[model samples]
Target: MPSNSGRRRAGADRSPEPRRKPFWRRALRAIFVWGFALALLGAIFLGSAVYMTARELPTFADLKSSQNGQMIVVRARDGTELVSLGPSYGRWMPYGQIPQVMKDAMVSVEDRRFRQHFGVDPIGMVRSVMVRVETGRWKQGGSTITQQLARTIFLNNNRTFGRKVREGVLALALESKFSKDQILELYLNKVYFGGGAYGIDAASRKFFGHPAAGLSTPEAAIIAGLVKAPSNYSPTADVKAAIARGEVVLGVMAENGVIDPSEAAAIDLSTVKIAKEGNQNSVRYFTDWALPQLDLLLPETSEPLEVWTTLDVGMQQTATSAVKANVPGGAQGALVSMDRDGAVLAMVGGTDYVNSNYNRATNAVRQPGSAWKLFVYLAALEAGYKPDDKVHDEPVTIEGWSPHNSGGTFAGEIDVRSAFAYSKNTVAASLGNEVGFGTVAAMARRFGITTPITTVPSMVLGTSDVRLIDMTRAFAAVSAGGTSIEPYGIVKVETTGGKLLYQHRSTRGQVLVPPHVAAGITDLLQSAVAIGTGRAAQIGRPVAGKTGTTTSNKDGWFLGFSSGITTGVWMGRDDAKAVPGLQGGRAPAQAFAAFMRYAVKNRPVEKFDTELKLPEWQLEPDDEYMMGNPDDYYYVDENGNMIEPGTADGAARTGPASGPPRYEDGSEGPGTAGAPPPAASEDFLDRATGRGNQPDPGLRAAPRPGTAGPASGQRPPTVTRPPTVTRGQAAPVASRPSAAAGAPN
Candidate 1:
């Protein structure tokens, strides 16, 4: 103001020294200038990031199509819908059709300032930051409903700062492009709920068996609660947890004034009825088993697929009923049924699928007991041994291990067929020794026993753990005339648009065993079911199978085939505890019969390719005769008189020795008196085959059945033979008893 010249010098001096600016004012000016410049730079950076992010956003049309696409649908062989996998969408509910209460509940619980915010809520963001700072953990999210929609549509749920920035820009763009109602509608239709359901309508129908338009307030609260964690809060997963979360949502609604506090308090959540399809229906086991195969058969694609499986609903129900009806309480059971071509027809994983989802049929691995003899005997047959080949059934010890028969008394000597029929442990062990353990393991591998098999003596006694499916598949191969087959549940896979992804075609199977070998194996199985330990499995029509009881009765198995279906049953405690009365011949055999009777009811009766001609032999002999005392092997008559062999009275005595004789006068035995009750013949036969003190070091605990065994390239332990010892001082007597017990018909 005082500038001009010398004249101004005086004026300037008089002008209060040019009115010197205050320090505070100067500092304020500098701060404002720098802040403006920094803000402009920040705006430019933010603008550049937004531009880059916008380019990555999907077109609106793409979003709409993705929301409308269906998930994979699985159907049974009869075109019955089994299950829907992946993100399953229901018919879209329009914005107007969405319930007001549902909207209010979501807004109140997820974001209270949803209406006031443009894309992000500043107040909510500050609150969330403060809470995180105070608690050192994220307690609240600052995202508005539009922001959530943006993230769902265009961004993954990543927590990186870059992702957050992208989410914010997309949210702003969405807010500018669409109305609040449209944003909410998209969110409701696109959000995922548990159990493969997407969108509010599908969630409502899946959880409550109704449409979203019909949702009650409590149901709306429950569905709103699912947004945070769909799986954890899903009603099907835990109804109590879902209801508790719903109560939280109700409380939030009340605090936000979206609902009357009294009304929120009075809401009856106890009456919620979850859909039964999610809880019951054991056929889900089959669906679960078959779902993974889709990945193997087809290329990955986002389009929804339609899968047709080999499941027979009728057979599945029958098998389920049979397993439930016969399995003893406190013990679990599993069953698998397949056709000759390895098409899995029915599978029951556990006694109650609702209580437990473990698929025992394909997953659980347990010792097969005598059921493993199938491989041993098959190896014997492959080694040129006939059904009538002589095998000693006496107490024979190998490498310090002595295997005993079920009653602890050997049958002395019998044909391979008779030994198999009676499930003689010594005979199986001897056969395993005769045909090398490696050969036995190779035979098992060839027949689809993919589990680790240590070439040890006990493996022949079913000591090697195996899955029920593998055993059933092996039996199926035999039923298919020795053709190798890989069990398959999926029949075909196609897109909903009818584009074929995969189709199962019946190819000529590799001949695993010669047809005559299978026929011979069938002959042995027939004799087993006809008069052997598996007699409980006999149906009127011809059937073949084997009975297996593991060590300590920990597992019981019955693998059999009738007509064209092969079924295997396994019963045991999951913890490997012995059930006193559990045996392959009792529960498992009975269950097999119950299922097969219905499984084969409609199929025409078909005889086995080979006739059942079992060798004539008695399974039990008198103690004296077994002890090498043929001269003293006499039968006592009704009058207490000794009868010689071939006598008229002795003709009736052709059957096995009942026991030590009881005289007409009530006296005890043939020996003078008090022969110490003659060491009561071992009455029960459920003993393990190889009884020894040495455990195989190479045998690790068997892995879960369906999983891989040892690490790749690992070799099984080498087989070492031990010295053999015979039990009695008297040599084994190969004499055939005069008794002519008829062969199995």
Candidate 2:
């Protein structure tokens, strides 16, 4: 109510408010709105571009198919074509001619929703992802049939995200352009079948020797199962494995409603008629065996390959003939021969690959019999025992275990040389005791025997089973001048165009056995062949070998070698039954002789370094009472007791009962003069005992077959009685200290 003139005066003093906003805030708001709109437009354009790019890919109708590449040829080291693995094509069939069962199998095993999906299956993808996440590996694959066809026709087989994206786009285009039947037809005709087969038609012909239209349910399932891994499930590679795969396929077919569960269950995969090809020759066995190795040499390859192996067709045939002729009708035999450097020259797995695909030479793990003694002897040598060192050939008990010879007769005290020559079980067991079982096991491993060896007393007698290949390699070590050898078959692999894919170079291990030690062992083995149990293995050259007959004659082995090569011959009933009166020297040794006779026909006669030159004193008899008194020699009379040099009972002093009789008549051989007649001078006894001062002219010590032992100052393990014996029973009566009760039968 103040007067207007007063209010107008007050208002004239106050300032008026502005109407426009500041420039910076308005500019910021407008910029944010415009930026968001541009980003949205860019995203839409990029998505459209991706879709358009995918749409431009080839349509299902325009999909091109190609014949599989040429065959992968396998050759021998001599450039001879041994076998071919590929491009064995058959007449192609149209979708109408193909079997519906085959198509159903493919859909069921590979893609259950082939007719329902547009292209890529989102549910399948999510499930695959979840499975992969759960397992931490890409174990599950979710590609639909269309997707697989797209990938196979246009994309390289690569596991990459980019490849997968392109595959999905192409799959979508394929679904859009073609009907389900047309897409399936393309897939059936373009997929790879194993064993040089290209499609369903080729696979049907290869497996059933018929057109695809006549494939049985089981046959169709087998063929479909091969899509995941053709080489693995091919009937030609493994008929049993292919049948097993078909069973899985049948289960999946039932799960997917492609076939009734009752019908699937009724399918007998074993009864399925698979066409049988002609009997494959022995060389096929070699090729089949080497195929896996070839795969390992070059794991991934797009082009055909040429695998060159170290196989001698002639040698393989020779081995085959030798086994077929010598092995008994029902028994099985395997022979493996390797070069000095462990190149597998020839391998005869069984009598015939057609009769038995079980490659005995490489796959069979059987007890090595006496062949394992090589490692035991090597262990003994390493433990400072000499071949000349004497161990009782009588019954021996170790930790309640008693080992005896097969002959059931023990020769009193015998040298390791004679014991090994005779294959005396008791002596070998005693040797195992001298050297700890652990040391012997280690020595076997060093020689390349991969089989696990236990620290049991019987281990000394080759109780553990061993692969022939591994055992041959172990022997190869001995023959190859003490170098470890890994037996190899494939020498070189190359692409068909002559590009070097792989070339094998001999990988020699450091000299594990000393040259002299090898020489010493070689001498002992030679004696075993020349005059001992391995006499049947005498091939008229300087061949060294050992014959082994297992307990109960269940197995026999003859392992022999020369400077040029080493060959192992194993023979036994596959059922592991006892072969009555079958000893190692009988059939196995004869086979060894026959094989060696041919193996060395073109090669020179190579003699082992049998010259073991030791000090004359080292070759003398190892007698505790006779060590310092070289002039004082005692001999055992008819009784087992030692007698003085001049005693009347000593007049009939005799060597150990184990020596071979020189004459059937009472008259003694020149070397055996019956205790020197007691009146003989000390010089004569020294000469008779192989203890002459300047090394007896008859005993060359180091070079002779008898003087194999420790180098110097090394003592062999002292022979001792077993700590434990059978309860409530006396030892068996024999030539020396009778066998204890409960001895190894």
lDDT of each: 0.75, 0.70
lDDT of 1 by residue, 172-232 (tens): 7776666788888888989877777889998998899988999989999999999999978
Residue range 1-745, candidate 2, lDDT tens digits: 7999999999999999887777988898888999889989976875565478567765544554355455678787799887777676566566787788898999998888777788888888898999999999987789998888877677877989999888887787777667788888888877787777777887888788888878888999999999888988888778888999999999999998879999999999988877775436677667667778866778577787888888887677667766666676678888888998878888888887865778888888888777788888887765544555556656668767887654354555555666676676776777776666787888899988887788888898889988878888887888877788888889988887889989898765779866656765776777677656676676657878787777777887888897578898888888899876566776677667666666767777776755422211111111100111111223222322333434544354345323232221123334446311111234543443345233222122223333343333322233343332353544322222111210111
lDDT, candidate 1, equals 0.75
Clashing pairs in 1: 399-722, 406-685
After the best TM-score superposition of candidate 2, give how far the Cα of residue 737 lies from its true spot, in angstroms: 27
TM-score of each: 0.74, 0.65
Cα distance off (Å), candidate 2, residue 345: 0.7
Q: What TM-score does prediction 1 earn?
A: 0.74
TM-score of 2: 0.65
